[model samples]
Target: MRGGEKCLEVFCEIFPEADLFTLLHVPGSVSPVIEGRRVVTSFLQRFPGVERRYRHLLPLMPAAVRLLGLGGYDFILSSSHCVAKAARGGPGAYHLCYCYTPMRYAWSAYEAYFGGDRLRGAARWVVPPVMKALRRWDAGTSAGVGEFIAISHTVAGRIRSCYGREAEVIYPPVDTDLYHPAGEPGDYYLLVSAFAPYKRVDLAAEAFTRLGRPLKVAGTGQDFERVRALGGPNVEFLGWQDDAALARLYAGCRAFVFPGEEDFGITPLEAQACGRPVIAYGAGGALETVVGLNPEEVTFPAGFQPPAGEEPTGLFFTRPDAEGLAQAVLRFEAEEAKFRPEAARRQALRFGRERFKEQARRRFVEGFERHQEKTAARRTGDR
Candidate 1:
């Protein structure tokens, strides 16, 4: 499951009877914990082939999400990467949002999502103005949220920058119990992520191609064809695998490659939980999760070395491109023995599912109490 869905799973467990509101709903797309709930979809769900072509409706999403009309709910807990945070609550209702990021496509990831070659013809001319409007709408909707719980410090910073609001950071969970060390690692490297443009799967494929090392990618998305075309003989595509299959791949890979800069990447932690090291780009949540040699730490002439008693679980490439990643793979090969499986697994435990649940519960209680206090004060003033 994706990071947002994983968080939603916990929310569903905590509030089993709560109704789920969204812009669209594709049955069987998410876990039973979520799908089993009374999911209320907006007008966007009525659009023809909305499940597959939702990205084409990005410009209309703000209106569609706002149209969800969540005013009657006593408490609304929105798990938002995009417009879900914009859901309107009743005057007395508390809207607490667990924000993944401040709409990446509308903010920092604009080029990655709608850059040259991706957009075409009339669409290219239309998207810029639409994105500008989306950004304004995104910022405007932040006022409706009573409190914001960010998925990571990286995202908290973005929330502050984008919406002028502070948020508490709670790193997303990884199923360490399920993804624990199992079989011996295979010779190949693994990259498990959607083939989205921002995910930079193409960078990983090109890096492995240059290294002549086997790189197995698991998952598919909008950029699947583009990424698949870029892969050389050494790169293998294993489109969307089941949990068992994913766990097997995680346990068997020599090291996991995370080329993208995520708000908070759960996959890297999942790989670490499986006792496999990671080779990631030195940016975003990877900076916090991956305890390894960074580019800045790599001094010329003498090069970099881990201090005594220090245990690294992965390595980071300074650049987020093919050549940079290829160099990192070579570096990992050199000091591969230093990255102990036990150490990697230990690091993974720090962000366990139990930890997330506990933190989220505490935050929710605090937010609810604050909302109650505000409502009481307002009632007293009116009298």
Candidate 2:
């Protein structure tokens, strides 16, 4: 399930009457309660190939969303990964979009998403109309929403750039307290990620193969076979793991290798909560999370060169290449003690679920009350 679904659950718990709306739904795929709620969709939800060609379908979303959202509801909280933020609002309703990023297709990762990499060429040829329409609608409906709740500072920047809107950053919640320290490191390295093209799981597999280190990959996606084909010696692919198994892996791994440049990676925080150090790419949210090895305070392992300007949380490799990632892992093994369990715990606390809930509740409630007052004033004036 997408992170948006989890956010929606929170929204539902807090506001039971709040209905769930989206572009599409795969029946029997999501919770019945969520599915049973008042249903609405963008017309693209009915398009034959819309799911397969989502990037192209994105442009259709604003029109489709507005079809359901226009002048409806008292409050709209969209757990958006796409143009759900474009949902229109009624007079008194507060549209609070929990934005993942300002739609990656039109912005920062546009080329990576549509630049003939894989389906980009076919999609480009096939869905020009939909893509164009979605872009226009995306821009138009963005003006409809009242407030935005960005999942991360990284995404907040994208939101501002793409929508010319200000957003409050509220990092997504992770159940860190439920995960425990295993107290022993397993011989294997761990990687858990949705197998999206941008995730770069190939890098982790390649690096593991090169280093001849034991690696266990957990998760499923279109790139599953491609990633498995690279597996050799010590690399193992274990389809999708449940929460228990995943938590155990986090607690057991020598280190968690997160190669992707995510908006805000929850897995890294999960691993840190488990008291394992992470080996992450230097850019994106990892820049804020992972700290690097220090030659002064700790021993530098051979074949590991520290990146310039790295802190002490975990090691950061600038390049996404297998060699660079492998070298960082090797170095982390050498200077593992420098990144203490307490330090890892401290980093996880920075994105604690309690903190996220507290911040979001305060911000949303304040915004909602302000909207409530404005609505009262408008009614009085009308009278």
Question: Candidate 1, overall lDDT?
Answer: 0.87
* Candidate 2 backbone collisions, by pair: 42-64, 59-134, 291-313, 291-314, 292-311
Worst 10 residues of 1 by lDDT: 298-307
- Candidate 2 lDDT over residue span 142-214, tens digit each: 7877888887767777677777887877777667776658778788999999887678899999989988989
Can you list the residue pairs that collide in candidate 1?
Answer: 186-252
TM-score for each predicted model, relative to the true structure: 0.95, 0.85
Query: What TM-score does structure 1 among the candidates reach?
Result: 0.95
lDDT of 1 by residue, 242-292 (tens): 888999999999999999988879999999999999998877777677787
Q: Give the winner by TM-score.
A: 1
Candidate 1 regions off by >4 Å? 295-310
Error of 1 at 358 (Å): 1.1
